[model samples]
Target chain A: MAHTSNYILGVYDDEDVLLKAIKNVREGGVKIHEVYSPFPVHGIDDVLGYKRSRLTIVAFLFGLLGTSLALTMQFGMMTIDWPMIIGGKDYAPVPSFIPVTFELTVLLASFGMVGTFMIISNLKPWGKAKLFDKRITDDKHIMAIDLGNNQLEESAIDKLLKDSGASEVNKKTL
Target chain B: MIAESAIREPLVTGGKTVHDVTEDISGRVEQKPTKTWMLAMAVSLATLAVGGYAVMRLVWDGIGMWGLNKTVGWAWDITNFVWWVGIGHAGTLISAILLLFRQRWRMSINRAAEAMTIFAVICAAMFPVLHMGRPWLGFYWALPLPNTFGSLWVNFNSPLLWDVFAISTYFSVSLVFWYIGLIPDFATIRDRATNKISAAVYGALSFGWDGAAKTWSRYETVALILAGLATPLVLSVHTIVSFDFATSVIPGWHTTIFPPYFVAGAIFSGFAMVLTLLIITRRVYKLEDYITLQHIELMNIVIIITGSIVGIAYITEFFIAWYSGVEAEQYAFINRATGPYAWAYWSMMTCNVISPQLFWRKKIRTNIAATFVISIIVNIGMWFERFVIIVTSLHRDFLPSSWAMFYPKWADVGVYIFTFGLFFTLFFAFAKFFPVINMAEVKSIVKATGEKKQA
Candidate 1:
């Protein structure tokens, strides 16, 4: 089931203008649902008041899981399950386990983080994407403000977007 | 005023605006292949044909087609393996390490370099598998798989087994990382597509990237984490590769210095390959303004540093061999420098050590022609380095009765030619199809200093 919503889309020609407009519209007490740009606008997250991502913490936990699994598997195989005397070394050599352990740690951490990111971003293989403007992926920057979240009238928000240097403003419904 | 003047030079030249950047980079992919590209592809395909014939013959015949005797079992096969693997390292360095260090200049070159890593690793992987006599079975046997053979499992202690895990992990992780970086660029391409097929193809590849700020935030975080994972991962890959030799009982192969030495040499050779490829790529594609001389100069500086480290490692190996007071070890070192394989040793020294010293001069480092020649020389030198280590040491071991000369058969030469064919063919296809430069990353850097005028 899809939840329909209304949004006022403001498009900007320049990133500088977009950056400035993000600040101006926010200061004017307008709620921004999302801002989209072709590339990362460095301070946009801070300007839009987004919290720092916890993906790194998740990556750390995943790394620990990888390390534990690798050590357990190696120790069990070399010492517990099949013990063969080779090169006059002990059956369970910790030093020898380092390479595989390290490789698995990296492998898991990378895959886990990407998986976490996909889930959190709602990026499913079969899910339909919400595209605001095709030009956002090319050269334009866009700001989409949800009508349900904003207290101001639609006309007032449209005037505010124009004053804040939006090249064009369009009403979008989904 | 002086300090302000010394503020870093602009990364992208020719005063390119954001729109111009999109046009310059994506246009290359969308445009019809030029006559030069067609000619180059034709030549590469011909080489591929020759290499293909060679590989087919090797598959038909057994490992006996190669001139490996009981004395020198491992030869050009392993040498080419290590050489190609080393060449793959520079790509990871440029893409992951430089990104972690926040070097903006990497933005322009990382895409091609990362592609080189994937292709070079593909070439490197063929040798170990093919050298196994029965590659079809050996591939599975190397893995620690559950099988019907009673109580038979992969030896956990073997460095060769470690290599199976390391190389595969490195390849998969690098592939994912490289593909992740390509998404936004693919989205850009998708939006710019004039035809339906192009749109559908690029659209699927981009995973429907909507350029939402929330998505961009997560994308940045993922890129950072991936870079962090890949930095140590790249170092470990080469270090593990060196263990395949360093853990052995052979005199020259067993050394405390192997890890660092191999890593440095890998970076040295890898940067050289990057330079070789980029020099031609920049010229043929007319990407002068994007991949500028500054990028070449910076990469050359890296070559000089890694080259010097490799040279130091070489000298240290000889000194340690002499100081160990073991006659066999001393003989191995002496033989490497003055024995039948002395020519190879000297070539390694000249190319790896002496040639890169030319970069110490600012003019030579910055000169495109000079950088190109030295890059090829350095790669040749690194190849000889591996050859010297494997062949020279194994040829004359403890038993003089069993000591013998190893020579390359037509199969040995052909397999290597096949890899070259494989690498160039894949690279040309990537160049023609994918965005050679990371357009989004470049756009970020250029936003502040990009050309204002529309190109």
Candidate 2:
């Protein structure tokens, strides 16, 4: 069950060139591995054909849990456990519960969303990252293609990348 | 050929390229601290020292060192607490609410503003904790934990307890959001690091961001969801704060208008503080290209709207007091405007209401000097607004026998001074170490124009 990824890294000086190159390469029946840039290139996700994220759905569920927890905790503490009168109101004031309920809902939703994002992205505190190219974090735009996934010849792929205005193309194994 | 009717100006001025964006922002981080930064830091540190001394005296000598009598127990401490909290509102509003609205102009200013939110909240929290007279126990007692105090739990019904949760959650969430935004920029700095130590430091801060398309896609999703959560959260934080007063039965403090009024006032003062800081920051860092004149103009428009809302709220308070036929309420309002504390009341009226009207003039709104002066004026007015609400209401209550005048001792002024020092000290350090402008978001705006130029 051992496997390795073979990648062809194409460096572009401009984002538009990279966008166009992505279209042309994909149209030529090549499956792109991934693209990296110092910043997000708009519409690149659609061109790369990524599905819409469901993080919002996760946030909603977390919010529901927080709301229930707040309600139950407040109800138990006030009416059941240490019921005392402060403002001469009911032991369990439903109106007073709303503010804490709202705050906890937001608190849990935000924390859950961030945690879910990190888990899905495979981000671990101590884990090492797979760096495609050093310059990709700088001004350069890099498009990495998996050579193992493609049936095209090596020279043909090289020619395809060079023809699409890549400043440099190199092969790397991960 | 179709003729374009109007041309939209670029968000980023100076026609900066992607490389230039990286260099301009990251270079500031990489370079040594400038002389201006040093001077500001020195002043902030000195103020911090003075404030620290005052806090020490207060803690050693008890809350009596402050000017809190039995009737006016919550004077400058609560006023300062609420003032700092209100000031923290603008950062989240700009970063979260504006982001949801697709305001691209926020890209330049959101980072610094978010930092301000964190620091301001820190300053805000300091007051309630220290005002407890025993801060060490107050921290733990504030939490609803299972303790050995005869199975006693915190009063969930108390708005002060709610504030403990609200401010802490706000500070933590803002920190995470700000740090998440910084990761890519941190990675950029990591890649460009000339020395090993710098690379390792920034590399760790980045949390191994490789900028993969899939990762970028998730990052964007998380940011949007956080913004969605924060928008309501920011509103609730202030609403809960207003509840601390509104839930009470005090004549001036008890009103349904407190929530909306406080919220509007928070945004008004927050934006003013943002303008005050950003104006100086833009000039100091030579970042006019990023923090453009248009940004200032748009923020001024928000100020005018919120300021008007606050002004109307002030008028409504008086009308309601008179219309309600409650003698205590009427007397409280009259006392605020014409009593012993009339000077503070007029200052609030003039600064919060009349001063912002100047922004209605297009010439003044766009003028940098005018905006700068008005921003400072608005903040001073906001401080007075909190003072007027807390002191004026509490000073003259139902019983004439209990009526007492509250005046702040030196410690009250000293603690407030301390917060300014703490805020600027943290801000100056942030400016020196981190990327002031968000390079990644700014780059997105330029991509469209950059493509046209490349063609």
**How well does chain B match by TM-score in each candidate?**
0.97, 0.97
lDDT of each prediction vs. the true structure? 0.89, 0.88
Please give the TM-score that candidate 1 achieves against the real structure.
0.97
Put down candidate 2 lDDT per residue, B353-373, tens digits, no spaces.
999999999999999999999
Tens digits of per-residue lDDT, candidate 1, B70-125, equal 98999999999999999999988898999899888899999999999999999999
Q: What is the DockQ of candidate 1?
A: 0.57
- Report residue B171 deviation for candidate 1 (angstroms): 0.6
Q: What's model 1's overall lDDT? A: 0.89
Tell me how far the alpha carbon of residue B288 in candidate 1 is from the true structure, in angstroms, after superposition: 0.8
Candidate 1 Cα misplacement greater than 4 A, ranges? A1-3, A124-128, B1-6, B451-455
Taking all chains together, each candidate's TM-score versus the true structure is 0.97, 0.96
* Segments of candidate 2 deviating more than 4 angstroms: A1-4, A124-127, B1-6, B449-455
